[model samples]
Target: MTTQKNTDLPLQGERYISREFFAREWENVWAKTWLIMGRADEIPEAGDFFVEDIGPESILIVRQADTGIRAFYNVCQHRGNRLAVVPDGSMDTFTCSYHGWKWGLDGACLEAQDAEDFTPNPCGHAQLEELRCDVFAGFVWINMDPECASLKTFLGPIWDEWAAYPMEQMTRVQAISVRMPCNWKTVQDNFHETYHVATAHPLGLNSVEDDYRLTAITLYEGGHALGVTQGSIPARRKFGDNPSLGEQIRMELQTWDLNPDDFQGREYETRIALQARKRQLGPERGFSHYNKMSDAQLTDTFHYTVFPNFATSINSDGMLYLRALPHPTDPELCVFDCWFYAAGAENAYTRLLTENGDASRLAGPAPREWRNYGEGTLGVILDGDAVVMADQQRALHSRGYKGSRLAHQERRVQQYHDMIDRYMEGYRPR
Candidate 1:
């Protein structure tokens, strides 16, 4: 999966701060593309549902009686009142708080006020307006456009490449939402390149090789991109006399009964050793999913950018899912979600690498948390990003600032903006 480099693509700063471009993106990109709303496993039983707000539209994803998932506009048929005001819960029927209209789990109009007053009764025939909804990789996805391509078709090679991982079986360990003070694209642009990691997240260099020359980057059709990083290895930038293994990598080796001292001078070989050890002992420890993954999938980190607004960092033990959503009307404001999942036997313990540090916790569904940008910490690295994003948004408005001057390593960022232009020009996925 490769694309021709278009060096002429313009990444003007105006796109980040202009209201006009923001409106165009909503109509041409957000409305037409398939979006991840929530996890399917979150709503396991009948009548369980979750509400997701994308821009100004509110979507209701519910698990139906027949064990299928369905999605509908959160608006009521009578007065246009939002049927489900809360984020999530289980309810046999959605009753409108304003007009007392009731809708069944299958979207049928179960009851309506003044049924006999109207010439034709709306109670039995009227139904809630529905959107196209489907489940992929354990996620509930919805599209506003009725004629959009199927999720499987839009995903292309990513669908097949990710099939080996037991993503559906993994348990979500952390869920967080933050109100950011920058354009949604700012977040996407940051993840499209690792050039900033060396400066903004220097701590990560201890275990991750941040050199672009060594990173394997692949560009796919429809703006999807992937960056594979070598794990358990120190960056070449570090200088020392037999620099020891990173604290995280040393702990990982100790977990599998391997001594870090054995790999003293051959730090790069730790990844392969870890993979071999995990393969030999995984099934016995209940990580049967390891048998399905490849050698690269076992020890390396694959960071995948899913087109317009989603990115996920997949590892052998867990995954980190991130999303950037446009604000309702402000081009400079957006919502960012960070979620972490761990794969193992139910009730098993796993160590998750976070900005705070490596923390051990039982793997399972965790509660969702919401906060403003400065209210709490998204950990060290993300907190640093959050601070810089606001400054970048403000700097883009400077008259002296020209369009982006990208390096070869930042081609993914250019590719992303180019795809946005294609969509604005009415390029639809087949």
Candidate 2:
């Protein structure tokens, strides 16, 4: 029971780069929360979409059928034009360069180009406007308030604490969005901290000893948030840090059996953790989260934020999405998606050696003066956490700064600034 580092909060760190709090956080927090707008396998098919913006809306998302997935408002209710402008394809309808307003693919508004433009069925009284879309856990949430609160009440407990992350049979090798300049709460204050992973990890930073307990700091109620940590098994076993202990015990028994194709093919991960260390027993009956990993901890480090924006890093040498996208009111001009995932069948040789960079930081793991005052090693963990989040967003528009407080181990950054101060205090709950 000892974990504290609020390090003086400063209102969710300067109202996350304010501009009168970014136009009242785009009308009380991105138009009534539940955000996370796309990635249902990136619009699987059937007229797909992928516009996304949500900070004063821009959406689209669509992916009808095969189990619906819709979101609209790329506009076209007729005299509002701007409908789908290729950023991602597939479309059975959606036309309106300036006149031809078609729509469909479940956004309705059938057609309206000529044939008398005054009633008598003007595209059945126009319809192309439905922004509610759901699909949590596989991702694709949206809500421009047509009667908010629902995405399981804005994913209260991170949809069952990420229900054993098979994350919809995981699939996605690269996505990288990028635009970066700053705020989005300075990238969630640099991923809420691993204490800057012994110097901002390029890789090496898992010295696993034990007891780190931070497992619960949720704040769900529209602007949802989550952060948890786990550490235990550490007795000693570092055959050169994770090299093929049966391919890390069949990828932790295929991420707890979402199926790594039944793991009976070949390299049964060092023949099942050397036969579960000769039947050790008891400890959630180890089938493999690297048998409660500890030779440098690797069983549960599950870091997920996703609230108010994004930040994901489910490990196993895979899955890493992290969006920010601010700057319409210039919260400091932002954008950064930084994604990566390499699924089964060695995802084409681990995505061709992560495209030759081999996940560089000079391929991590080297003493390099164990933070001897940091000359290198993850360049002091990405240069002292990007020089303390760019001088804390430049002394938060300094004038000799005034705000600062919150520290009970930064209660998840003050429950993400009291859930963005309960949506800048307007929380339209109807």
Candidate 3:
């Protein structure tokens, strides 16, 4: 499939606030599309598993003794009781707390109480309902629809391009989920375009090129989009003497023993210099993953949006994985998850930027944490985005708000919503 022209589907505000629209999405979009569960490395050992709650369903993904991963609906077949209640754990078999029905790691029913009493014994025949599961770019993906396309097919060209990064070798250093008072799409639309960066995240302009004209935006087939921008440089038109070398860039240059002052009038050259330095010193510094990446990959920010509800900003040595998940019932509420991964020596101290452009240091793998909006920071930039989402959710309800008047740079947003319409109209990818 090739990338299509801009879609003319109306982006009415009702889609963001209507219960009917949200219900349609659950049935037509969320239930059919491939979704990211978590990283494969999270469950390395046999029997290790994690539970991801998406929409109204709970999916249990486990690493089998055979070194393959499998996913199943976290429900007991006998009485429809949830099999795995907690987030994750390791066990020889999944024993249903309600009926003591034992299911093996492969999802086959091992034992059902008084099974012989029934017409046919469930032990040998019964099985947990399974979902299509696949691993790509180190992420465990699950699809609810039995007829859904393969993950590679659904991802299109993104599959091959992402192979250059050793994401599987990276370790997740930070995981945070926040409950937001807004529709899930509200969060997605925000990331689809950088047009709001100048106003919503002014501080980010110091380190990123936010000009839509300068950024390379590619809208791909299957609703995936990519935005590439020069990093470590100010977005301003003029590069005057003593150009701003934001704290992050200053610290980065210092790490390479490059004097920040020397790049005063030549700030635009910093990114190229930094890329060369990293390429030269990466392997010795234990960042061998850099060798597989191109110079642009070493310095530019490659922001990708996977159809439906996932976005990631990938840097040379780190990445910010973001997801906007729908609430179980409310059309006006959603869950936002932010995870940061870094490629370096195991347990090595590394500093990476969060989705909100804040530099965060990690010693090793970090545990997932939950927070409500306003309870704490999602990072300075993200906190601002959260506020905008909430406000947009409210504004979308007003009579004055007719529909979205999108800019050329926001074409990704248009394509995303158009894809949603296609799904709602029963269009499935072959």
Candidate 4:
């Protein structure tokens, strides 16, 4: 399990394709880690549910009588037919499609066809398997191991670092289901570095909106490393003349659109309000601007990772909610979903998400990088990410590239590897 150079320390090939390593991950990583289950707001009403799989288990995200979200095994205790087939919806209670067995959101087994045969009515004795469910930021996260760490400690100091962006404020713009060939880690790791930015998002680099890069990376002891980039630029310079240094700045000045007022005026205009704030705040200060703003000058982008399995991209206009769930026995084949949340652009959201008509204008090319994965696909964003991850998965199977080195400037990526090693090596136990 030795890694490559410090910059490229994470295992590329073996970790990606080895069934043995994938098993170890299920036991060590997926089984114990605080994995994201579903968006919190999606199931805000009572009895709403979404089925998500983590490693070897199918997690049923449930909305309780108290209007709180809970996680349960989506299995029937009697016959084991999957309870909820649809990915998401609302229900008074869940009835097994196979048998007429029923359970409430609290997981109480309320009904069984024949009660007399099973003695004490089968109500309290059999309940859907329950797991620890905690709501954080805007998503529901569940842990299979009841003895795992609290979400706060698991996230380390990410809150202070992400204090500014109004994460809850942004609406879910798009929710897309895309299945990729690569492991979830492959995609997550790919996103955790700007090392691939120059090549991966060359058009993304030179867009008119904002300049973003790696300076926003964060590494902690508990396998948590966040690499974010802002979409901002200087007053005199064009985009990319001097790219953004890190994730913090990306959170501050990235291109985000919000609910337009009656007159359609955002907090700040692109040239004056947004860039002025970035230049004034400078690069030294981490994003804690929510309290500092006058309420009129708070437009910003927030592309941040919340530990183990969630990454959020909040632009001034809207946001992209990304959830990476474990892929059962085949860790490399995890399910990735994206939800776009926008303030005033639900119309635009639907159009861009659907890639309605030649939407490539939405994504500007990166002048610095070159591997435009979703070339000529019109204008959908998820297609681009899917193309990149699937291709990376294919490359991982290749024997030609074992692993490589990382630049010291990419400390966040290094820190990410160190965290993974710490956990896999048995040093940091949840």
Candidate 5:
């Protein structure tokens, strides 16, 4: 059966640069969806907690004494003071720094200073308000909507396809959270389509089969979608015969332990060859997970976008997790998080080479480093995307600008907006 193409959902310029549009999203979209905040194993022990700021709300996700994860609004019950200012730490109980009202890990209000000052005691009855929290794919997920669907339900088919990869045991070796001067949707839209690679990521053609026929796009039951593209081989391009590009492809094959000389004229066959080589040598190299993966999983890239903000690209070698967060106030600004996870890096001797040839032993729940948008390195294609994003944000204000004329391959972008529109119209998961 053929997948139906999405209708062109008009994406207005105001939606990207207007304050009123952002406010609607805060209420209709951000407040109602399950968000993947961090890894569950990050707080393996009791009392270990981390704070995730979503729009104007700050949520405290903590490991309880019973070893289950819980989430609470990061606000003092009394007088609206903030709690847990630090990003992450371990503590027996959270005592409000403002007035010393203390709360246990389970969100029970244990103590309140000046206890006898009130007519009726508030300590025993009062507790920090709890939000729905759950764990899946090794990540701690939380929903502000108390009646929201379970994490597994929210994730739909994504939950099962993702299970093929050993996400639970992977290590986050590289992370960078940067503030960008573009609407959050810009980042999400960029990740949903491969058409841009022909121009935006020229070198990418040397590695991935970017042709539409070779790529399959699936729009799932929920707003979630995935674009699976056959990769680890050179795509047919005008530069296919370029000598320099051929050498680069050959070097990559050699690195994967596949001999470049074996497929000299037929470089496109390297992907299947590498997969066979990986299947033969993977187990000994500590790739315990590859044994469970399919042949496509061993060679191609399966990139998934989880509704409102999160996007992840999974493969046998590594996973790239990206999230676009709305800036608390500005429609023209958002925070973009980039995290790289390597599979089977627990074996110290086996090194995972990152996007820029930075081979390092990968392991984590690693700490994330913050950088200004134009500051530190974000690899090659991503850095280029960052520069264009700000300019894209600026161009959105042009009077001549019309709604996006999307290609069939870019149906996910239109569907994404269609999903957002559904949320705005009061559609919430039951």
Candidate 6:
């Protein structure tokens, strides 16, 4: 729970938009740090595989016959052709369409064409390059650097903080990926703080307090950070008029089997009452995980920023996971993923929140949805952030642009870049 504000660090536009900087990130930051691929539930069976592309690197994560998860470079050893062309599917062995080089799910060379024609047989001796892979909280994580620290050590306290929630069992009801025309850090910086919530997302004011003083920004080792604010309460600051708050509260109350009218004049009590009510009746409602959550977690939003690209806004019932990944070659373009996971899929409380949203849909066994930036599939709040990022990207190329002037609340943003600098300057395998 350490909190410190360091606003003195300057963030330059070059770090956001320069091609050279993007290359540096691939070499130092993304390459050396652990990254979340996706939920392991997506590939529960043997031979189930998924491909995650970050910058120029494409990784194949697959479930082995022994039920273990293994990750390897998607490149073929024959001619460097990509082994797995599709995003995800079930595959017993990866056969390169080019030279017919066959590779096992364990990334070992299984067979090859014209073995006698070569100076030396490449079978069994040549294996697919494998990266360090591990699983935590139901997500499959991969580190390009083989010497990278363990995922638990890399996650630090954030791992312990999220251990209570049933993240491993949570169902990913909705997953949407959008291509935004901005540096990935633009969206990453935005999620690190709530300073723009008052103006960018006024409706959020109803449920989230926008005052910076009340927001506890906690930074951890490995460049991770957490932004905590009072949730389930009305905004401390007025933002003209937002009529949706009542309906939202009413919907939540109805879902929890509480009468909305009972808290007509005492809307502030809704959060506390819901916490106590859930604590009492949670097991019967299929939320057995509620027993593991703290009272604050039952009603508060714990927003966690996992180093470079991943961020999660977690609560008792569900989580809104956001990730911004860099493009392979274009520094000005990036992909944004908006995913929703529910703590208890069969329960009314989790279903009520995840069932009706443009950004996310009802949790079931389904593949993720992918769309372009302006497709409007990301919902309002994320769509708004995308629009802001586009304009910010365009402005960064202007000659007058110098660096970002950050406020104290944006100290996490500063800390984020400072961490990036450390990575860029630290040990990188040659």
lDDT per residue for candidate 2 within 1-430, as digits (tens), equals 1112223435543565657767776777777776674458766787877786644457787787555887888878767867887666787887878878787888777877673756666666777778777887677877788788677756667677565444555555555454445677776757754544444442322222112243444545544455544322221222234332233244444433324444333322422442343234313432233343343223334667756777776653345666676656677766655555443324222443244434332222111111211233222334455456666777777667666564454466566655665666765433
Q: Give the Å shift of residue 238 in candidate 3.
A: 8.1
lDDT per residue for candidate 3 within 70-117, as digits (tens), equals 999999988899999999889899999998999999999998888888
List candidate 6 segments past 4 Å from native: 1-7, 239-245, 346-363, 427-430
TM-score winner, 1 or 4: 1
Question: Which is superior by TM-score, 3 or 6?
Answer: 3
Model 1 accuracy (lDDT, Cα): 0.84
Looking at candidate 4, the ten consecutive residues that score lowest on lDDT are: 364-373
Which regions of candidate 3 are displaced past 4 Å?
A: 1-6, 237-242, 345-349, 352-364
Residue 226 lDDT, candidate 6, scale 0-100 = 92
What's model 3's TM-score? Answer: 0.94
What candidate 2 gets wrong by more than 4 Å, as runs, is 1-27, 30-34, 37-46, 49-60, 63-70, 73-102, 105-108, 112-117, 120-127, 130-169, 172-210, 213-302, 309-313, 317-342, 345-407, 425-430
> Candidate 5's C-alpha lDDT?
0.81
Error of 3 at 2 (Å): 27
| Ranked by lDDT, top first | 3, 1, 5, 6, 4, 2
- Scored by lDDT, the top model is 3
Ranking by TM-score: 1, 3, 5, 6, 4, 2
lDDT for 421 (candidate 6): 77
TM-score of every prediction relative to native: 0.94, 0.32, 0.94, 0.74, 0.93, 0.93
Task: Enumerate residue pairs that collide in model 6.
Answer: 173-363
Candidate 3 weakest ten by summed lDDT: 346-355
| lDDT over C-alpha atoms for residue 426 of model 5 | 80
Candidate 6 lDDT tens digits, 1-430? 1012223645667777788888888898998998998888889999999998888889999999999999999999988998999998998899999999999988888888888787678886888999999999989999988888788888889878888888887888778888888899988988988988888877777776778888888988778899887777677585334323455657666777899778766766777887888888887877888899888888778899999899999988778889999999888899898887876455444554454543334445446778887875466677677788888888988779766788889888888887887787783322
lDDT of 1 by residue, 49-128 (tens): 99999998999999999999999999998879999999999999999999899999999999888888865788888889
Off by over 4 Å in 4: 1-12, 119-121, 160-163, 208-216, 228-230, 234-302, 343-385, 427-430
RMSD of every prediction: 3.4, 18.6, 3.5, 8.3, 3.8, 4.0
Pairs clashing within candidate 1:
none
